[model samples]
Structures are given as C-alpha cells and as structure tokens.
Target: MAGGNFMGRVVSYVVNELLVNTLANSPAFQRFAVRTSKRIEDASNLAARKRQELQEQLNDSLRKFEDMSQKKH
Candidate 1:
C-alpha cells in the first residue's frame, strides 16, 4: 500500500508539472501577459504625469511666497 501511494504521488506531480508547462506556452497566457504589461505601463505613465503636475504647482506657490516676502521689504 505504501509503494502504491508513493507511485501515485509521483504521477500526480508529473501530471501537474506537464499541465503547468503547457499552460505557460499557450496563446491565451501570452495574450494575458501582453495585456498585463500594457496596463502596468499605462499606470506608470499616469503617475509620472501627476508627479510632474504637482511639482509645477509647488514651484508656483514658492515663487508667489517669495514675491510676497520681497514686497514687504
């Protein structure tokens, strides 16, 4: 009984590995990978744009503050 159980476990492992390998090579998985990559790229671009906008706003505020201080002197 113990030997049979060991053999069954080996077969199961082999079958699972084969299935994983097959799925990885399939067209559907490739398409999914492409779509995920595109989404990440888009999110990164949007974050960069927002960061730049915030920096510009901060610089403008600092300039206004400096101008106000000069006027007091």
Candidate 2:
C-alpha cells in the first residue's frame, strides 16, 4: 500500500508538470492575448476617426454661419 501511494504521488507530480509546461507554451493563449490587444487598438482608432469627422463637420457649419453673418453685416 505504501509503494502504491508513492507511485500515485509520482504520477500526480508528473501530470502537474506537464500541464504547467503545456500551458506556458500554449499558442492559443498567446493568440487570444494578441487578438484582444488588436481589438482595443482598432476600437481606439475608430473612436478617434469619428471624433475628427464630427469636429470637421462642426467647423464647416461654423464657417458657413460666420460667412453668412458677415455678409449680412
């Protein structure tokens, strides 16, 4: 019974080591992290583009209004 217990312990340790090593080398985990980072970058870029477009539109309208006012004056 003691020898059987010792063998079980050894098997458990080996399995644990294998799991840790496999996880550390996991390509899927790395890809997931990379994809998450790219998504964040794309989202930020999209927000910036929207903001710039809105600002340009606002500027154009303001300029047109200013020109119309000046003409009336």
Give lDDT per model, in order. 0.98, 0.96
Q: What's each prediction's clash count?
A: 0, 0
In angstroms, give how far residue 36 of model 1 lies from its true place: 0.6
Query: What RMSD value applies to candidate 1?
Result: 4.3
- Which candidate number has the best lDDT? 1
Question: How displaced is residue 27 in candidate 2, in Å?
Answer: 2.3
Q: How many angstroms is residue 32 displaced in model 1 relative to the true structure, after the best TM-score fit?
A: 1.0
Which regions of candidate 1 are displaced past 4 Å? 1-20
Please provide, for model 2 over 52-72, each residue's C-alpha lDDT reduced to its tens digit, 9 standing for 90 to 100: 999999999999999999999
Best by TM-score: 1
User: Candidate 2 — what's its lDDT?
Assistant: 0.96
